[model samples]
Target: MHSSVIATQCTGAVISQRERQTDRDKEIVLQIRGHHIAKLDPLGISSADLDDKDPPELLYSHYAFEEADMDRIFKLPSTTFIGGKEKSLSLREILHRLENAYCRHIGVEFMFINSLEQCNWIRQKLESPGITELTNDEKRLILARLTRATGFEAFLARKWSSEKRFGLEGCEILIPAMKQVIDKSTELGVESIVMGMPHRGRLNVLANVCRKPLEQIFTQFAALESADDGSGDVKYHLGTYIERLNRVTNKNIRLAVVANPSHLEAVDPVVQGKTRAEQFYRGDGEGKKVMSIILHGDAAFAGQGIVYETFHLSDLPDYTTHGTIHIVANNQIGFTTDPRHSRSSPYCTAQPLFTTFTRTRLIHVYTPPSHALTVLSLACYHQSRQPHAISFSESLTLGHPVALIVLDEVCSHM
Candidate 1:
């Protein structure tokens, strides 16, 4: 009788452990499905057509799970899962984290991508808690970069106050944003990057990103004709080529900024052609060695037909440059007209998606210090096989610290 009782007890223990494991798995599956459904954007639907909704939870009644079990699983700060560490959290903490991950300074829209792997990769980066926290060294680097961008603009205003230059006064962070793209691409084995942009911030990019000498840039402002033949173009319309060592990755890379005409977005196709030629010469069958970056203004990107034409050529085997990183500096105003008067759709980035059905990723950065820029850079180089577009919501009338003050005021009003 004693032996039989002991065997029965062992069998009961095994059954109990299996039940617990099954329950945990069910909860995980339900949470994943619910989160995915919640994030899907219903295109062409107005907010008025939708009813008020509560926190999303699985309505499937077959599984027995508590309200606490349905709470989404996120990587909470100070909670280590290593060595079977238990994650114990209150309901409030879980809700707070949910808000932080999806509603913070960085916003991503990638659900339209047909590939499950691509969607999940973007979801993991954005939904993981505490991923936006920056190290002390990174903070210092951002500050230094911002100083260089602002100082360059400030110096121009002081010295050549009367010159007719299209300055990057309010949107200085774009300088560092471009550098981040170059650094990340170089680290990911891209040896050459050809880029094209409008005249708005060309002088600053030539000085900083292409490493053009300050003396050469300043000479353009001087009241004199060019001494060198074929150097007759204006400062911002000029092109640059530099092969230099990228200090961050310890790699030598080639950079070329294609010369653009007065028609701002005409350089879009030129950049693609140059990048494709380079890839062909280098025998980059899969476009692992050469890439391109194209910068667009909010007005030109939405109004220009060439932008649409270039996006359609992305998938053609002969014309494809593997991928291009498009950065749209949206000031929310097209020239002097507001978006309310200009665009029928809400965002400029959505135009290509609606028309061409291009497989692209869209990320919006509301603040300069957010990780969206890094995420955008990484997505382009890591995927290295598809096109990506990222739009920055910046101010035309206000810049950094002042913009912070404006934010505070707007928040107070809210």
Candidate 2:
């Protein structure tokens, strides 16, 4: 009789334990359902039973809720009931109120809880407004230029091309511009012209403008040693020296582009220094001869503080070079990002900074395949002997001419 009673009690206890577990499971399911419904409704609802001790995994499993769904529940208000009875609310309620306040302040319709904190901070500090309204003309111009240069396509090609490949569109513009500079320098009786630019179309400029032997370039590509001292540089990065007799001016000129490192705009000061030294060596009187021209990327020029530093040195007593002409290849995008994101200012090239020069001028030219304006701009820059900048916006068609000149001196002293 004692054994029978003990067995019966044991069975009853097991049954009661199972029943309690089943009830607990049902309660967890109900809580998750309530959380889901509350999340869907923006009016905000809370449950008092929601405690830190509740097993998140069990509640989520009972309701078949995904991880994301559970996250949403945790973000909801924590009041047990949907009434305004409690003066101070739980963590969820506080968070919901904060979110509502932020959304109202920023005028945003919805808030993403995951990024809410960051968004609020940005809204308050950066004063980030909604999207900008672009004009029809602006849209058309942007599309036209992007299509012409095909900057994206060029970038893709460069990535897969030869190891040290040159950029395409800018190269096309630069080669002719360089040729014009050489031609003009020759015409002006400049015995030597030295140029510097970052790696854009260095290879193209090398092959076409500098007239570097294609065979040497090919050998360099093959990684084969040649009897040339320029094996250290990419075909485009290599410098060249050219001597020519100008048919029009009946003068001889020597031209050389300085080899530069990958540091963009860092070469500006170096070029100026080299030109001044060359002028002094030639024993030329002030502003009579020797000139320096620098080509810059639009995004790099504006985004890099170094460009401003280099520009500030342009008018300095010791660093001046008649004047350094700045040419900006405005691709409207830098690397993979757009201009608006890269620069705070309207223009990517800061031409206005040099306004102190009486002869300083800023010209924006559309690029076309013929590059007539680019050629013309170079001629003007060489003739004027003044500081100038030309910006080539992307709206210009591919193969378009884009160039600017800064002529700070009449002629090279040598």
Candidate 3:
């Protein structure tokens, strides 16, 4: 029915649980909400940099107060009202759900968004704090993708022990999530996708998600031994494109990953420009036929100025690519250095990126891979349902096509 009805019912459900008082978990939930534990225990902390005093919350008494059921609360959002689950849940249950919703493999840092309006828009959109309903087949496919990601990296590590493959060891889910994006895009009638990213998981993305031939990857790795070709970059920096058949629609989908220099974020602008070109070449002036997805390292996405430039570029009349879905790889650590020394913010999702926009709808998604992918799927489906840009009637169209900027600065992304 109405979003207000949904909102009212959701809040009333929470109140009803408090009125009933079924178990200690409900009491723990009340205490947890009072403490605002979700803000206190974010998943962005670098485990490598963690000390004995900073063990993970699940491992220690991370909460301040001591209660009889302190250990009985669920830390994950499995029972939360999110994800389309219809069961009535206790406050503690929803708190656990909130924790996973905000502090899992992805964590949106929109709390720092400058304007109250922008914050409210994001809260209403992606931050509804619930999980999406996923089929068993989709779950199994996601698991298979995860397995493929880890298995491939392990193979490369064993084969080239000393080589810096920049393995997707921790963030294997990235490739799968991206694959989900492409699948979602094609489902939305998007024909071509131009992606750009730094070098951390480029090799994994190249080999696994891009579906580049294994033989080609092996050949490239062998070529990296000698500097004869003078390609100027290593194997991981190399870019490739592959076309896949969208069986249901009987359409051809082209996925292109643009090549980049050693600079962490330089590829962003290039990807946007390239996506715009694809739109023009295809003559889809409404900007619906093409899309862009830029992957970034958490450190670079926050530290670099070019990242900010791309956000501004999208608004310009000549430079706008209609939309782009930004995905920050956010491996947590920048090479060997920890984040505490690199950035001042508590989260890697920087505020300067989109918080300042006056009219644009900013969507921040930072949940774990399973939830992130599901949310992403719903976003694409909604985007597909959004009314197409009508004939030019106003100066500089108010609403651009959908641009989903995914933030996965969570520790579990590892």
Candidate 4:
């Protein structure tokens, strides 16, 4: 066996191997393509495709796509063809069409019409239009549908209270809190975010935070009777992904809400590990360009030992990921179990546990009507790269339970 053949088989290159040749057999040295193929394997050739004199088992390994390749794929223009002669339209005209289509689709005739009118007046310097093409009956139908889809009053009466057993007030508090995290992540330079929360007001958050199409939600609700295994999770467990342009950074950001199982805080560590790996691959060391935000149920955050295990891993050498922003969706009761029975902690689930770790701050937020605390908490977390816990405590009527916690722990050693 020639040394050149063995080198070529191992390294896919041609190089010299002096040890294989006998001291007396110098004249019989192997030569390939004008180079001394003593030990050196030929460069730029596969092992399997080597000349018949030195063929091997495996061939060329397929090259994988690099980051730049993925970016090119995503930015490729859509193949869907739009028919019509392309003509420039003013921003006002484009906005008018957009407003009309949005309102018409959502059945929010009055609000969209009012907004459109205001926009038209400002841009075109024209007075608001009088009653237009849509008749009173048609307007009523649109308004009724919009109310059914979005209005808090209708949401509470027919959907939230009836379907999920959550009050209108709770939905109001939860929706804004979810949205606040999404909006704040976008405001920062975070390219993508994933949220995990149990089934509470998952439907409301989907509609409001992720901006899922209302028609899709309605269709799911309508088909519940006929479909046994529909492509829908319970309103709270369903997940959504949205991409938006961050106004501050003038760059695009992706937001994802992970579908969580009923195992409660099980998803917390999974989300953290994933986000940290993603950030590292993207060259975001020590939370410079990426973030992981987790939403938790109050009882699960307190009672689940996984929550403590996850918190402990935040500062560990192998799994420390700068830290994740943890939000506790504290709804007071875990199904039927009250807070007293759920845990022995005084403050809520995440706050007391986080206090065990140094340099971790737990902020108790009392704002239910205003989502300012949630938004501010996220802002501070991203800016400081610290693990912070923002707990939202419910009102007296809501039993004064903790509503939400925002945890932002930074990797110290990194």
What local distance difference test score does each model get? Answer: 0.60, 0.44, 0.54, 0.42
Task: Arrange candidates by lDDT, descending.
Answer: 1, 3, 2, 4
Candidate 2 lDDT over 300-372, as tens digits, reads: 7777777677666665677666655666655444554445556655345443443333223333333311101
For lDDT, the strongest prediction is 1
Best by TM-score: 1
**What is the overall TM-score of model 2 with all chains considered together?**
0.48
**Per-model TM-score on C-alpha atoms:** 0.71, 0.48, 0.63, 0.48
lDDT of 4 by residue, 1-414 (tens): 121221110111121244213211211111111111112211211211123342221111111223332222111112101101322232223223323322121111111122333333322211122222467865564455344334643454455333442222332444554454555666655577766666554556666556666665555655453122244565445577777664434668776777777787778887877777877788877664666677666666777888788777776767776656666654444554545555665435344455445224343332211111111111100111111122223332233122222121123223
Query: Where does model 2 exceed 4 Å of error?
Result: 1-162, 246-250, 352-359, 368-414
How would you encode candidate 1's per-residue C-alpha lDDT over 297-390 as one tens digit per residue?
Answer: 8768778889888887888889988778888766444654555557665455653443326676666564311111111311110110111122
- What's model 4's lDDT at 173? 44
